[model samples]
Target: MELAIVGLGRMGGNMVKRLLRDGHRVVAYNRSPEPVREAEAAGAIGAYSLEEVVERLSSPRVVWLMVPAGEPTEQMVERFAALLGSGDILIDGGNSYWKDSVRRAEWLRERGIQFL
Candidate 1:
């Protein structure tokens, strides 16, 4: 599967590496450019911005978030919801509150984006 990962923290960076090792095409982005460079060196496509990340993927794009919970995750979700089209998938890989996850899922669903 081809996907874009919006956070390149330790866990996110590792996920990108593992996904790439598994033959998945990963588009990597980070708040800081260093991690993106590291991911790029590991054979993942590096994205400097959310727009670049979205543009790098094909239709029915899949975006996974490994950002901090609460505000950061919320911000990224909203941003991606705008960048991604219907039929796209948004995955939250962080340790978020269950209720927040449910709310996010419903909110994204209403916008025709699948949330997980």
Candidate 2:
């Protein structure tokens, strides 16, 4: 499947590599340009910004967000909701509180985006 991974930390970075090795097309983004370039070098498509990440993939886009829980996750989900269209999937792979996850899912649903 075509995937967009947001966050270039250990989990996200390793996931991109594993997915690419398994023949999936991956569009990877990170706060730092260095890791983006590194993922590009590792055969993953690197996106400099969230907009770029969305543009690189076809809908319905599947984005895996591996950021920390709480504020960062909320902020990224908000940003992604704005960037992604209806039917796009946002997978928050962080260890977020269940209530917050439920809230985030509801928020995304109101915007026509799907969260997991």
lDDT measured at residue 44 in model 1 versus the true structure, 0 to 100: 98
Clashing pairs in 2: none
- Model 2 segments beyond 4 Å from truth? none
Query: For each candidate, how many residue pairs have backbone atoms clashing (under 3 Å)?
Result: 0, 0
lDDT for 113 (candidate 2): 91
Put down candidate 1 lDDT per residue, 1-116, tens digits, no spaces. 89999899889989999999999999999989999999999999999989999999998999999999999999999999889889999999998999999999999999999999
Per-residue lDDT tens digits of candidate 2, residues 11-108? 99999999999999999999989999999999999899999999999999999999999998999998998898889999999999999999999999
* lDDT against true structure, model 1: 0.94
- Indicate the worst ten consecutive residues by lDDT in candidate 1: 4-13
| Candidate 2 lDDT score at position 90 | 96
Assess candidate 2 and give its TM-score to the true structure. 0.98
State each model's CA lDDT, in order: 0.94, 0.94
RMSD of each: 0.7, 0.6
